[model samples]
Target chain A: MAEPTPELIQRAQRGDPESLGALIVGQQQYIYSIAMSVLRQPEDAADLTQEACMKLLRVIGQYNGESRFTTWLYRLVVNLGRDELRRRGRRVPEMPPMSDDDGEVIDPLQSLADDDRWADPAAVATNTELQGEIRQALDSLEDHYRLALTLYYFEDLRYNDIAEILDVPLNTVKSYIRRGKERLATILASSESEKIQPPRTVAKSDVPVSQPRLARFAWALGRR
Target chain B: MEHCKEYRTNLALRPDGDTAELSQHAATCPECAKAAKRAAAFDTVVQSAVMPMVPDDLTARLLALVPGLAQPMVRSKRWLRQRRAFFAISALLSVIGVAVLIYGLYILGSYVGVSEIWHTQ
Candidate 1:
């Protein structure tokens, strides 16, 4: 979405109802998208979107225009999302440890070995099932990782903006996104294994010799 | 091997980052090239998955909330004016009521000789 013009923002800040209405109208979809990405439920996301609009109305005057307006707005939405999660008694889950006791970084891609299934850009780009798997994996991730990835990938936000919105350092933002993608790849690989495995009682007629051998080997290796 | 690790790490962290140096390294290394392809694929899938269609009525619903945007300041000013007028009127009435009560007490005291009782005591 295009950023609202400075004139419109100034008018809105001056309490011009028409300008405020226009501003909210322009940003509602963007707000809802972020809310949906965070909440992962249609009803909750919708409620959050409306609530965010109300909040913007109340706090528009407090915006000093030091940062990009959207960045400020994103911080508001993220904070609201965190509050909603807390109200529901769901603490934002902590990111899984990135290093072991030996202080060595655990490389998430180490497990993939020679498996190039996730490495095929064309397959991922065209496959609907893989897209669904990715969405599911994203939903399962911890809040910080999910938020970082959502802002970076979905909103096309820069690392600097994401870092500011997340209130973390630049490197931390990168770590959240990097680890988030790694975790997603891990989840997708496992789900693919489950789908590829056939029943033990399958007849020879049902089995393609080459297909099952490769499937079985990939599945076994993925499990290991 | 360490160079490959750095290349892969950079790819995983930022598939879209400026990678001229990394690209040069990947050109010489088949393993890093494969990793780059995988990172690109993963980034595509993630970008696709994270985007959701905004609800149709979201704009209308949010715009409806805008009417009250300027109302609070207007309403608060009017409220303050009304409250100040109210307090002033109440204070006047209170002063008048107190004076009347004191006058009535003095008259009753004179008629009943209660002031004399106090003076004598």
Candidate 2:
């Protein structure tokens, strides 16, 4: 497919209906997958995807094409995800005032570090108990780290491209990956208790590699 | 040996060349090797997460979004144009306001000047 050219961008920026329509067509699945990956709710993902696209149309001129168009779109989807998380936080029951002069309760999820908390980090990691902890850990990660790790490992972006998209230095991008991975490893370790076996290694070098089911579910979710 | 260490770190994160050193490391240095193995497993898991058969309606749905996307863009352009026009009209009014204020001040100053001259006479 042709890259989103200057002309296409100009037309879209001007509100050319066809251009706007084409832009949405080109990016809908990507935006939806991004929302699904972060939010883990199909209905919410679909809603965010549409909302992100509409926002993109309204502010298309803000796109300077300095980075790939998709990167900016990813940023939009991520912001929406963050907003959704904050909204959910409000809906969650807060501990009622213990006393008349009671202070605000701190978010327990925010206080704990990533590892030693949740065992599995993948959103679809099957164990329900582990999944809850993992989601909390994921939500706690600073936005850039979460965005970078998701786009890199989950979305399969290279470290360099992520740097470009996030407008951070390459080393910074690496730091986010390393930190995110380490945090995930920690969470998995604490939750699983069993020394998590790497996907079963084949001693016989010739055996085909086995894929983990949780990973498969995540991948399917992304494509959907 | 130096290259091997660097290679091991990368492989520990995502397996690299020569499973032999990594395997040996796993056998002896349990932590390093286990990490390497886990990294490999994680890569497979993430890769699995990344690739899925493209969905059935994704192509059509995406195409459908384009028109929806364009409608607002057009509306926004018109909105922007209106905004600019409003600003321009306001600017013209502002200039007219300043001119009127200056004219009134000049008339008042002339009356004061004439009265002073008559008082001196």
Candidate 3:
């Protein structure tokens, strides 16, 4: 992969299309994965990746190169994804618990189960079970936790890089990762073990509480 | 309190703290040991979930969408932004210039005693 060199950055910053293309091609997957992990939707992830690239181009001059290009990109993409998710008024959706006899729901242990391995071909092919489990657990995680885990683990970034990307302190990033892991574990475990637990009622009243004006605008956009 | 505080600090610094003293203490202290084990398990689970190996085409797709490169809309929008900033600065300067002109005229008139003459008239 071609590194984001000073010349390429300069040309891209100057609005050179070729340089921009090279940069985008280089980082598209990284940006897209982050978006997908956060949005949990392929289409939404694609849109955000495109949007982040565009935004990056527009603000390239503002980048002082104080951090790695990838770190800056991570921050940009995650922030956009979070904003997009919030604008859509989509909180973590709850997963249905597994059921036992008598139709009683059980709380499944929601950590990364022994079955959820990225390397296993069988696991990858018939990933419905694992995917569903991950989706459920991830959806239950707070936005910050989701971002931290996605950036740190999925992106294979270091703690300091994640801290830079999330614009948080190093300790804060660690805390987020730790807490996020605990939450995922609890959610996954609870989902697996208590799969028969009854579904909770989701509220329908939509007076738009606590969402910012921009979020309200995005929510309206998301409706379309 | 001191022992508990030291343990908590050690736990926070390195989740996998393997110090002999910490290990012995954890074995003796059920709470610390449980917390340590939980932390270790949590670490393993997170390591597995990240799935760092990205798809091969990810980089290509990313580069394809880069602004001012692949997307015409981005180029257009960037041009529009530059145009907007230019116009905004121009308008601001125009306003400042008008304000300065008014102030200059008022000061010149005052220096020439025009205000006194106007007051008499």
Candidate 4:
């Protein structure tokens, strides 16, 4: 999502209804994507997205512009996601907070890092089978790994931005991505093996890939 | 062989880094070259998987909320407008009523002869 202009953000902070509507409309999809990555269910994600928007409307005046708006918005969504997970009786794993010393020590090798590879959107759009397998694999990951991977690859956030959002050290973000990818690779490899087996009835453990729902409401609104 | 291990570790840890030296090593090493290719392919798949297709109704659902969320603010504006209208109407009616009462009193006094009543008083 394009970052809402600073003027728009300022207007929103001052409780301008048009600006607030624009801001929320622009961010709704992004919020939903983050929610889906965390909750792994469409209904839950949708509910979370609505909750976040409502919460944003109520608390937008409190925004101080001390950080990037997206960063602040991300923190909001992440916190809400955490709370929702907790409400569902899921354990939101706590990573150690970044100490001042840890925060100050930036790795020289990390400075040289260029881990910005992302899937080509056109390519991803066509690879339905691989996408399904990957989604299943992602769904099975722990919350931390899933969240880091989603923010890094999908949101295209830098490691430092992710660290700020996740409230962890920079190295911790890297560790999550690396370990997350490793686990994903392992899962995909195993799934590939299972796919090669003789045809059998669908098992209870199998999950079907969810179909993307087209926004009929959006289309209707546009026509109006 | 040692370089191969280092290259693979770097590939796994930081797949898309400024790896000019690593690329040079991989070019000379067949095993590392194959490893790099596989790693690239895997990264692509993982990225595709992690990025979800957001539901279509999400934006509409959210925008639908904007009006409700903004209702309290809107309600206050409407109330203020109504209050201002009420006050203006009240003030205008009061002025007209007072003017009519004064006119009627003046007409009564003129008919009754105010000079005669003042003399009697």
Candidate 5:
């Protein structure tokens, strides 16, 4: 995540119009990516992304500067997503308040941090039209779970960071990733094909190797 | 495959990489190990596939919708155009309000026989 400079943040806080615009442009992609990944239809995702931008402008003054500005910005987008879900009459997860639960909460991040998190930073397998298949499976999961995966996998946020943005417990974020993956596995299993090779491109720079959704694509094929 | 369930469950939990327990379990249990490795590989595919591909003009396009970010904070042309009706309504209301206030004051003065244009000073 690109941390906006303190000078930039202060300029935004001071309501410098240019600074505000800079802030929006800087975070637009991350917000758009999350919105696109979670929602099934591209149009809906586009609509929600626009809504989030307007929302940020409408409420920018309310930003207290207590939490990281990015977190606050994400929360705004998440809330907009929740609102969209509500409008569609789809069931959505309850949003928790963003209290100062920092160290006060029993974050199990440390225990898992050393082992689980470090297990396989880069995914190293793939084959065929795994992209569309994964998208289909992803859309099938519940909105909250999909949002969790979007944050954890795509946005590359930590469990606690996701929990903070979604305003849920860390365990809940962990549970969401686990369940979402399992559900995705089940859906992709419904279809099959062969041929394999990992994609040469992973826009993300942090991890050299990307995930194995194609492995699951083949893994799902093997089960059939 | 006894440890497979726990291993898979753990696989789902971690943000990146495999956990030590999962790695250890996979080491001894070939069935689960292979499955875990494959599953992890599939995870990589999922990440790459599911990534959102946005347009180069996405920021400009989306920022256009944001109320303040798209235009200047003060008296932007778009802002003026969007709020013209509002400003007009406000202006009308102010004109009416001043007229009513003057009329009311005139009536009050006339009733008390104080002063009026018709009655002179």
Candidate 6:
């Protein structure tokens, strides 16, 4: 749960394998989650996590330590994910329509009356199929918004850190979260008459593939 | 109600329990009250779905693959892995050898008038 330390990163750059492994293990979940949010595919997320870590391994010496390691690392990760999206012909950050009054841009989700299901505990909790609905809602969002949402709730990152990682204005990141959440509410709050029909969660036959990894990670760090 | 919209946006950004302003605003304004609930529900759904349960081998697997870590592994861990493999093969061969020897002895006993050797122990 601890952020990668400056000393740990320095040790890794000095070519200590244990330290290197520790650094990647520290952020493995975060990297995978970020990739999953962008790619929306678990296998792809895993692959990206591995790829990003290796990329860092080689390039780590060049890391001038100018920024928090994560901000720099995540920038590399987001770019890789975005590039893959572009290669796949899936446009990232497909911006929603912006409404303006005589010149100033306004929050798009501002106009709609709040949906009923937004607050309905039963609908959210009881809809055994709601996970699919949630994933679909995430899919509908632009890449930037999805990235912000994932970092906010999944990584538990502060908004300012997210802005720095995404290399965007702080206000833009804030707007992205606001709009993304609103869009999700709209999607999840489908009228009872017209339900959303989307793909269900993929069934993973094998799971918790790495309980030992977390343990070993701790073990390796203690070896310092 | 219109000014309450700003409060609703702020309400949505933070988690449900942290902001007292959300409770107060939602109490006075029907819209924010509903927005708060929906936002909470959204948070619940996203958190559950987005969280990753990763493979435990991730770090080990990467360490194995990394160029710097590629230097011959810690001698003891390698020895342990090799020792395990060696024992497994030895046990398998021992079982097979014992079965074959027993069958051969039984065949020889029948031909050499030593049939009693096949009984008792």
lDDT of each: 0.75, 0.56, 0.63, 0.71, 0.64, 0.68
Docking quality (DockQ) of candidate 1: 0.30
Tens digits of lDDT, candidate 2, B1-121: 4433544445423411345554565566654444444454444444334322335545454455555432322246889999999999999999999999999878987988867877899
Interface RMSD of 4: 6.8
Q: Decide which is better by lDDT, 1 or 4.
A: 1
Q: Which one wins on TM-score? A: 1
lDDT tens readout by residue for model 3, B10-32: 54335333577766787788756
Model 4 chain A weakest lDDT span, ten residues long: A104-113
Q: List TM-score per model, in order.
A: 0.68, 0.46, 0.50, 0.63, 0.57, 0.63
lDDT of 1 at B117: 80
Model 5's CAPRI class?
Answer: incorrect
User: For model 3, what is the error of residue A86's alpha carbon versus the real structure, in angstroms, after optimal superposition?
Assistant: 5.2
Sort the candidates on lDDT, descending order. Answer: 1, 4, 6, 5, 3, 2
Interface RMSD of 1: 3.1
* lDDT, candidate 4, B1-121, per-residue tens: 7677667767754634637877789889985665666666666666666655667766666766765344322246889999999999999999999999999999999999899899999
Give a tens-digit lDDT track for model 3, residues A1-224.
32378888888878888887777777776777688677866677777877887788778889888887778878888778778877999764222221112221111212333423433333343545655576667766776777777776543467778778777777677666556565776777667656556444333354346754544455335431
Measured with C-alpha atoms, the lDDT of residue B100 in candidate 6 is 100
Instruction: Indicate the DockQ of the complex predicted as candidate 3.
Output: 0.10
Candidate 4: segments with Cα more than 4 A from true spot: A96-125, A198-224, B1-7, B12-16, B23-33, B67-121
- Residue A188, model 3, lDDT: 70
Instruction: Report how far residue A130 has shifted in candidate 5, in Å.
Output: 1.2
